[model samples]
Structures are given as C-alpha cells and as structure tokens.
Target: MTCSIFFSTELPNDRPQVSGALPRAPQRWTMEWCVKTPDGRTHINNSRTIQRATVAEVNAIMATTINGIKAEIGDLATFISGRLTSHGGTRKNRKGGKRR
Candidate 1:
C-alpha cells in the first residue's frame, strides 16, 4: 500500500473591497490524502478545507488522519489473511477443483 498527503493554500478571487468594512479572508488551506495500491492504482482520495488554522493544528489533523488510515489498512489485512488461512490458502471452483 502507498499513500500521499498534500497541503495547499487557496486565495480569494480579485474583487472590489467594500469601504469601512473588514476585508474578506482567503479560503486559507486545503489538505488532501490519496491512498494507492502497490500496482499504483488509486484506492481512496479525500480532501478537507481548513480556515484560519495554524501549522500545528494542520499537523495534528494530518497525523490523526494518517493513523486512522493505517489502522484501517491493518484491520483489512488481518481480515483477509484470516480468511485465506481458514481456507487453507486455496480456493475451490464450481467444478470442485482446487485453485491456488
């Protein structure tokens, strides 16, 4: 399994500012994660937009997300391995033939 994390900033579009009013804040930042298989095919892709966040906050969020992904992958691997072992690492065809 492979994974990637990306961080980016988003700027607001050019527009006339109103007089005597606080300026609009930029969209701020976006964080994205992509999980891929060993074959280089994408398995999961997700993103979140953050506003007015500090670097520390971003890092915390990223770490948590990564840990969650790791746990999920581990659980899936365990389940698959258990199933394979239960079947003696062999599969049966419709014609009662054993398949590896």
Candidate 2:
C-alpha cells in the first residue's frame, strides 16, 4: 500500500460576537493523510485541529521535520555510495579502460 500525507492551515471565516465576552480560540493547523491501495481505492484521514499554537511550537515542529529529512538524505547517500563502491570504485569505458 502507498500513502500520501498533507499538512494545511485553516482559518475561521467569521467569529461570533457577544456582549462583554472574549472571542473563541483560533483553530490553526491540521495534518491529513491519503492512503491508496492496489485496488484503486483511496482513504482520507485527518488529525484533530491544533488550536492556538505558539510560534515556538511551530518552529520546533519545522526543525524536527527538517532534521529528519536531512538524516534520511545522508543515509541514502551512504547507501548509494556503498553500492557504487561494491560494484567497482569507478566506471570504465566499453574498451575496459578507465574513463578518467
């Protein structure tokens, strides 16, 4: 099975007003997932809305995600390099001479 994930921000269209009352907390971010099966069917799922998230909270989440992606890239580079080294440290021409 293969899955795709998405993240989005939502804002209220309008806020209700009342006499001498504070407004409701804002609804901020949401995480959604779309899953697909070989049978050509898709399923969508959503996480509960995140309300009133602070700047630091959002920053931390971004930093963590970036770090995770960087780690994955490094691992992939290592794997590819290892594969190349195992096959032969360098490529050769069809005439069996090193291509420089």
Candidate 3:
C-alpha cells in the first residue's frame, strides 16, 4: 500500500463557474485525490475541497491528514505486535511451538 500528498492551484471543470462568478478567494483552496489499483479498481474523493481556505486553513488540513496517517500506522503496529505475541511469541519452531 502506498500513499502520497499533493497540491494544485487549478480547479477542474466541475467547479462552479459563471459569467460574473468571482475568482476563488485567496483563502480558498482545492484538494482532491484519485487512486487506481492493478486490478482496475479506482477510488476518489470528490467533495474534499476546502472553501475560503487560507494558508492556515490548508495547514490545518495537512496537519489533520498527517496525524490520521500517523495514528493508523501506530494502530497497525500495535495490532501486529499483539498478533505476534499471541501466536506462541514471534519466534516459533515447527508444530506451532515456541523455539528454544
């Protein structure tokens, strides 16, 4: 599994547009992501864009994403540790018995 973070200033056609529509405020920022797997599976977040987002606003987004990733990693590590410990410890010999 791989992950990445990216930033872009351009908004896609789906974004609201009108003859007199004012440009997005400086604080407004757009964010999105798409993923395709080898098996022709795809995933995307269509409504993740931020409105009237400022530098601080964007920073907050980044911080929250980073924190979430960190928490998931920590949880996975703990799960792995628990699984290993429960299965006759990490080092085992044949017949599912602990090794000397």
Candidate 4:
C-alpha cells in the first residue's frame, strides 16, 4: 500500500465554533492514496477532516504520525520528501525573505 496526502487549516473564527457556518476552530485535511503491486494488488483512496484542535493534538500528529508514515514509505525518498514538505509539514512563512 502506498499513500500520499496533505493537511492544513486556518480559520477566521479563531475562538472555536462547534458547529454551523461560523466555526470556532474549523480545520481541514485532504489525502490522496493508492495501493499496488505488479503481481496482484491495487487500491485507491481519499479523505478530508474539519474539526477542533488542542495544541497537543496537533503536535502529537506532527511528531508521531508524520514520522510513522515516513518510516512506512522509507523506500520512496524523493516522493516522501516532497510529500512531507508540501502536505504534512508545518513551516510558517517568514516576513522578510526566504526559508522560515
């Protein structure tokens, strides 16, 4: 099984809305996936998530889940690197110029 994905969110209703158009802490995540083997295997998948958050919850996913996925797809170096940066990464853009 091979999977690739991206996830992030920034909401104006910063306080944390439990429901409705005005959400309190609405979040979002999207994933694209496929499973395959030349011999006898193939699969496909996708998903999204919008919900609340605690600092710890996000951190745990960053620390644990991200690393776990990298290890799982350890053979795919270039693909994993770009996928992690583009999707699973958490780098805030800086004001002045370059990398943050």
Candidate topping TM-score: 1
**lDDT for predicted candidate 2 compared with the true structure:** 0.32
The model with the greatest lDDT is: 1
> TM-score, each model?
0.40, 0.28, 0.31, 0.28
- Model 4 has an lDDT value of 0.36
Report lDDT (Cα) of residue 21, candidate 3. Answer: 27
Model 1 alpha-carbon drift over 4 Å, by segment: 1-27, 75-100
CA lDDT, candidate 2, residue 72 = 47
Off by over 4 Å in 3: 1-25, 32-47, 75-100
Task: Provide the overall lDDT of each model, using Cα atoms, as 2-decimal numbers.
Answer: 0.39, 0.32, 0.36, 0.36
lDDT of 3 by residue, 1-100 (tens): 1112233223354232222222333333344444333455544443343445443455566556534544744533211100000001132356857556
Whole-model lDDT, candidate 3? 0.36
lDDT of 4 by residue, 74-94 (tens): 534232211111123333685
Q: Candidate 2, clashing residue pairs?
A: none
State the lDDT of candidate 2 residue by residue for 1-92, as single tens digits: 11122222221342211222222322243333343444555444444334444334533554454345447445332111000000112334
Q: Supply candidate 2's per-residue lDDT for 45.
A: 42
Q: lDDT tens digits, residues 1-100, model 1?
A: 1112233222135222222322133223345555554555555444554455443465576667756876877633211100000001123455756545
Off by over 4 Å in 4: 1-51, 79-100
